[model samples]
Target chain A: MVQFLQQIVNGLSLGSIYALIALGYTMVYGIIKLINFAHGDIYMLGAYVGFICTVQLGLGFFPALIIAMVTCAIIGVVIEKIAYKPLRNATRIAALITAIGVSYFLEASTQKIMGTSAHSFPDVLGTQTFNVLGVVISMKQIIIFVVTILLMLLLQYVVQKTKIGRAMRAVSVDADAAQLMGVNVNATISYTFAIGSALAGAAGVLVGIYYNTVSPLMGLVPGIKAFIAAVFGGIGIIPGAMFGGFFIGIVETLVTGYGSSLYKDAVVYIILIIILIVKPAGLLGKNVKEKV
Target chain B: MKKLVIALFVFAMLAGCSSNGGGNPAGDGYKIGLHYELTGEVADYGNAELEGSKLAIKLMNQKLGEDKYESVEYDNTSSTTEAVTISTKLVQDGVIGVVGPATSGASAATYQVLDGAGIPVISPSATANNVTQKNPDDENSEVYNSVFRICFEDSYQGAAMAQFAYDTLNAKRVVIYGDSTTDYAKGLTQAFTDQFHKLGGTVVATEYYVAKDTDFNGTLTKIKDMTYDALYIPGYYNEAGLIAKQARAMGIDCPIIGGDGFDSTTLVDLAGATALNDVYFTTAYTTVGASDALQAFIDAYKAEYNKEPGMFAALAFDATNLLMEACEKAGSNNPADIQKVLVDIEFDGITGSFSFDATHTPIKSVLVVELVDGVQASAVSVSPKM
Candidate 1:
């Protein structure tokens, strides 16, 4: 029981980071119907930015995090403008392939700039673990969880109440119709990219603090898993993405704990298969007609 | 497009001209081909080896000033393709033998070409047993007879450490966590597990993660409640350092043991000073109490590079000088004669006394080092039991 609870805490902490990344995938897919595969590299960029700030510039942790978020948000807009906007009318496959190309380019460029070695992140928060009822809790874990929740709440507020959020939903539903309704679909799309990329950047900084190392290609696996989470929760559904990310994290941790660690990744893909077979629309997704 | 064609044609002609010197010498000095990763993922290892080889060549030239050799060096960038390409170029360049390609994977990738071309290749620190031993993945599964390494095979490391754990530390229960992708890590893990069980030790659990996965929280959390006398991690410094930090944070109090992969100074740098307590690894050399010659080499290295030499550098120095000695003894820089001479040569190296076994693998003792306050303090020298 205590062991189970400990695993849950571990799961939640891991899941929250995944959720933050999943939100990016979900948001971009919602607006443009493109699975911005380069989103994860944005996360890596965020970590490096925060790394430069905290390690090189001697900035505080929160300030570094904010700077990373802002920089990545701008980068996101620029990437969409240069890479995606031109290919908007092209085939979806072409855009997806370009997303992958962009991802590889970002990875190679980062590796060239900062050697492929993993840099040890300095302890921004003092290293201290408190044992509560035989379960260990660290400051990084608490901060990661709390920040993720608060960010999600802020996201919910923006989506539910803000005019930009309304435009975002309008564009996601039908871009032509949203343009007809004077939503300025291009601006909405750029705003969506900014928010999504900013979230991924925040997740990147949190991971650097939690894991104590950052590398050029660190975003590849986490990015893939977050994409899987988006798909598992129904792509383009925001709340469902959070649910899926958390679920994947908990299940992955539990599988590793009770069963073989070797099977952990295999089990996640297996669950994805089962989910697709059972509910193609996902838990929180709805079936909608599409125009060919 | 025409310019590109012209450039490629010029490159091919230059390559063809170099092939004219294959397996033969013309000048007063012999040419030796060198491949080291100056830039890449493991560039640190490559760069250190590069410095050591350079220093060794310079020392040899000073001693035999008139007969000093010229080395043709190339950067493989730690890529297997580049390693093979450079090895091919080296053979074509008519080098007597090649000194290094740095890591085991890179060395293995170049072996097939070097072996078929009958070129003798000695890697300074490639420790995977299959480098000279039979690689099951090979098309013929035959030993690459031309391949040799200066460092002790990884299997010996695992077995020696397990024996020490069982006999010295009285660790009857242990858990193994290792990298699954690389042959070096897998070979060590298997050897350790076999030797541990043979010594009446029970391995409570064995876990694995690929190279990229940084977070070991899930695996550590599972082991949190389990009873184990020690934790054995056989992987590179980057992952090992992080694992040590995360394990310590999770309140694991057991002694963590590792292989030569933990030899890098970055291990201490990454794992943090406070978390280094009880961390131990089996490595090549410790300069704490060394012979005057070894101390001299260390001093020279520091003076030249303004930094301490890592194990890779030390191994490379031995590799280059040892090959130089073989060339002198054979009275020729011919690859075949050098290969024959290398089998019988017995010499003292910076790392240890080196004598080739039947397979050209060095017979040497492994030094165990412990981390205290992020410093590698020498522990014990574990020799192979007779």
Candidate 2:
């Protein structure tokens, strides 16, 4: 049905955002074995940074977005150095708690600075609709989908072919071994944060343009949902996060479209619960055998 | 030496006792506490409510003389727990009456504290019907009896919005998007559907989003395929603004109607001028005109704070005045007497006036305002048919 197809397109577009944010969560989890709770808040900061560049500084969309990505990358490195780096050998729980604290501190700071009001983002892509198979899709949605896919491919290529990418995988596998093999373990981890935060920043800009609104706490829900997507897809698995994000987005859309809208979020969480119950490791996560 | 010593001790004791009683006097004067949210996502709403209360207080003080009553204020900062804490502090401070805990959730939290202390608390904007609909025989019913409100319940506002869509806008079918987190949103959606269907309009589809959701494309896409005359979104400004922007971007292109939750400058700022064009919403009052009373309040507010008072300020002003009027009519600061007088008293307000019903819900006119280029242009007053 046209309606069904349209919903899928809509789902994919939203899912792409979730996918981008999920990658950040998955990568951090993959390397650090810690859920960076503040990752979402970093995405929020990215959006605000992009907002300031575009709205206040009068930069074009692309320039502002690039600046936002670079800014977030720097913030990511700083956060890692200041917050996570010091606790590199700390318990996972301690790192997680620190992440949460950082998240709260960032959200509170944004609220204080931004004054708890929603700011309208400048319309970058003109609001024009293109019809495909009796389904009307906006230019913004199309751009978001295309850009997300391109970014995902770029990430895949980077991880598979690049030197730093190998270093990241090596570090993830065995940080001590990688360090012994002359790999800069800390630099690799910082690089992972940089890439993850940049992706989150891009997601922020995309969402801001798509939603046409930005707020201090805008990143919180999407951040949580993206993390769910990462776990659902098998946390630490890059492609898995992509699949999971799209899956969650489509499922949410379908549930709200056909089922009771009130229970849509409930349905999404239920899916996550069911998926987790079925496969403790995740949909695509491998069962690791711990060496004695 | 004994007389001198006794005189000094008595004077010191008398001074201490007077200081304690002087905090709040009896029939000669009264203390009314205002608990409102001054910060957070709904800060604008709280700010408006506070402003209205302030204006009302100024008028009451001017009419009754400042010596007749005293007013104190507390900011709940848009937290339910804070509302409870503030209400406890206010009651401890011996406020004879209290006004506002703005939102329904905050009101629910403060109700227990204020009701336990036998203080009459009235909210100008807390419209959840259940807030005042307590079981008469239940022990908790005491809270409901002491609480009152100036705004009509969502039941009326929802029905009014539905009627406007069906009769005025002549929409044949409507799609409803509701925010499920707040009782205000759910209540309005229910009312809109019940009244719209009752009036022979078909609700093609209904969607929902949470308070924190920024994406509505999935839901909007579903509705885009369906033929609908108008979209009814019953949600607060935060989500509503995003919904409006995304809805427009999706090419749904139907008029959107909402409730007082949409009466925020933030909504326009969030939605943008192009997106918010032709949007209609309902509110308790409007700041468009300079009516004699409104102008005077505005002048006083500007003189005091050097800024134009928003709608919440006007409502708070009226609420304060209403309490003072009740006190004067009762000729006492006793909570029970003032409560009875509040229920029966009807005075002209900036927005207009009606006495409270048994539920403490005011029977007043609702204003339907149209957003013209990001500003409220026209306001029409609608009263319940009953």
Candidate 3:
């Protein structure tokens, strides 16, 4: 039972990271209907930024995290403006393909700048472990949970209460109608990217601190897993992304702990397949009519 | 305008051809190919090999006139497909032989092209047994005739580490965590498991992970519940270093053992000194205690590159000089003659003095180095009882 509880704690910590990244994918999808494959690279960029801030500039963790978030937010807006905005009226596939191209470009350019090697992220918070009921939990894990929950609440307030959030929802529901209603669709889209990418940036910094290392290609797997989490919970639904992230993380952890680690990835995909077959729309997704 | 464009295109084509030594009237050197990973995942290993090969080539030219030999270099980008493409280009370039594509997967990927072209290819550090043998799992598997390596096969280090753990460290119960994606790690894991079990040590658990995986908390948490005397990770320094760091953080402080893949200095960088305590890894060379010849090579390397030469550089220096020795023994640059002489040549290198076995793997000693606070404290030479 203690072992079970330990695995649960591990799962939740891992899940929180997936949740942070999934928020980015789901947010972009909610606003523009583009998958934004390069969102993961933005996360990678965030870690490198945090790495520079802490390692080179000798800043503390919070300052490094905020700076990384702001830098990534600007980058997110610029990427949307340059890469996706021109293809807005074109086919969705074109925008998706361009996102992939952007992803490769970011990976290759970062590899060139940083060189093909992993760097140790200096220990920002010294190691501290606590045994609660024979289950070990670290200071890093506690910080991850606190930060993720706080971000989620902040994201919810912005999405549900703010004017820009209303404009975003209005545009997602009916862009033509929202434009007719005097909503700045372009501004809303850029704002969505900014917010989403900021969350991803925060995830990058937390992961760097948690794992104690960062590399050029660190974002690839988590990006895919977060995308899966978004789809599993119901893409374009903010609450669903959070639920999906936690679910996937816990399931992956439990599978790896009890069953074969080799089959853990396979199990996640199988659950996704089952979810798709049972309800074409995700767990929290609703059916919507498509215009031909 | 169209006529001018056509004329310019023709001139550009001529320029391209001429630049490949096609139009150089004074070209008389025997061109050898240096196909290595200059960029991408394993670029560190490839770059070290490049430095070693360059130093060896410079010395070789001084010994046997400047125009006697020359090398054309290409980067395989530390990828298998890129290796195949580069090997094909080397064949078309009509080089005598090639050295490198540092990892086992990339080196093995070049076999079909180099084998059919009858080119004798040598790898400086490819350690998977299958790179030189047809099927290393089978006892009677034939050797890959033209493919050769200067380092001992993966099984040698794996078995050596197991024996060291059992006999020296007195470890009876061990856990195995390894990278599943590469033949190099898989080969080491298999040999370690077999040898440990043969010596009557109980393997507590066996786990696997793919390359580029950053998290090991779930797996480590599971392993913490089990009883083990030591942990053996058979993979490159990239993942191994992270594993060591995570394991130490989780409070599992047993002695960690590994293979030659853990030879890089970057291992210390990834896993800090505190985390790397009580770690031991098997390799073909270490600078802890060096022979006079190796000391000379180290001094020369530091003078040239302004950095210490790692195992890959040392082994690649040996591989390049050994190739030149074969060329001299054969008395020609013919690939077939070089292959014949390579089989019988007894070249003394910084790593050790050994000739290639039937499978083209060097019969050499494996050194197990112990780390104290991320510094090499001791290295004991051990021969695997095969």
Q: Give the TM-score of candidate 2.
A: 0.85
Tell me the DockQ of each model, to 2 decimals. 0.35, 0.29, 0.36
Candidates arranged by lDDT, highest first: 3, 1, 2
Report the Cα lDDT for residue A224, model 2. 86
TM-score of chain A of 2: 0.98
Name the docking class for model 2: acceptable
Candidate 3 recovers a fraction of native contacts equal to: 0.52
RMSD to the hidden true structure, all candidates: 5.3, 8.8, 5.2
lDDT of 3 by residue, B1-386 (tens): 42245346645754663365331222234677788886666776787898898888887888776656777777788888989988888887777778887888888889879978778898998887656767656757777778889998887789999999999999999999988888889889889989999999999888988787878888888888688899999988888888899889888999999988888777888888888889999988887888998998999899998877778888889888888888888888788888899888898998889987778888888889999998888999876566
The interface root-mean-square deviations, each candidate in sequence, come to 6.5, 13.5, 8.2
User: Candidate 3, A32: how far from true, in Å?
Assistant: 1.9
Highest TM-score model number = 3
A1-292, model 2: which lDDT tens digit per residue?
9888888887898899899999999999999898999999888888898889988999888898899899898888888887899899989999999999888667755664565667778887887888887888888888899899999999999999999999999999999999999999999999999999999999999888888777777887898889999999999999999999999899888887888778988888897898889996789998898989
Query: What are the per-residue Cα lDDT tens digits for candidate 3 across A1-292?
Result: 9889988998999999999999999999998899999988889989998999999999999999999999889889988887899999999999999999888767756665676667889989888889899998999999999999999999999999999999999999988899999999999999999999999999999999888778878888899989989999999999999999999999998998999777778898898899889876789999887979
Tell how far residue A89 is off in model 3, in angstroms: 3.0
Position B276, candidate 2: lDDT:
84
DockQ of candidate 2, scored on C-alphas against the true complex (2 decimals): 0.29
Which stretches of candidate 3 lie above 4 Å from their native place? B1-30, B38-44, B55-71, B134-142, B296-309, B328-333
